[model samples]
Target: PKTVLLLFASGKLVCTGAKSEEMVYESIVKIHGVLEDYDLLFKDE
Candidate 1:
């Protein structure tokens, strides 16, 4: 099953439908990695 992520304009996110907590973290990490690969992640100085 695929997880669902709900992102808010307030910079808050909710990950749901995951089988376990680890799955949630993994999903987030994967997403972050992809964003990084595409240079879509914001960097703060």
Candidate 2:
């Protein structure tokens, strides 16, 4: 399965994949983890 991750200033994520729902969830969690590690999750308004 393949996937792509997109991040927006609105603190939204867009994911496109051709796999199972579990995969989508895992991908989202992983992506968020990466972003958090880089301090890119989000900031106070």
lDDT against the true structure, per candidate, is 0.81, 0.78
Q: After superposition, how far is residue 28 of candidate 1 from its true place, in Å?
A: 0.7
Per-residue lDDT of model 2, residues 1-45, tens digit only? 378977777777778873888888888888778878989755677
Best TM-score among the predictions, by candidate number: 2
How many steric clashes between backbone atoms does each model show?
0, 0
Question: What TM-score should be assigned to candidate 2?
Answer: 0.70
lDDT of 2 at 18: 39
TM-score of each: 0.68, 0.70
lDDT of 1 by residue, 1-45 (tens): 378887676657899999999999988988778778999766556
What candidate 2 gets wrong by more than 4 Å, as runs, is 43-45
Relative to the unseen true structure, what is the C-alpha lDDT of residue 22 in candidate 1, on a scale of 0 to 100? 91
Q: Pick out the ten consecutive residues of candidate 2 with the lowest summed lDDT.
A: 9-18
Give the 10-residue window scoring lowest on summed lDDT in candidate 1. 1-10
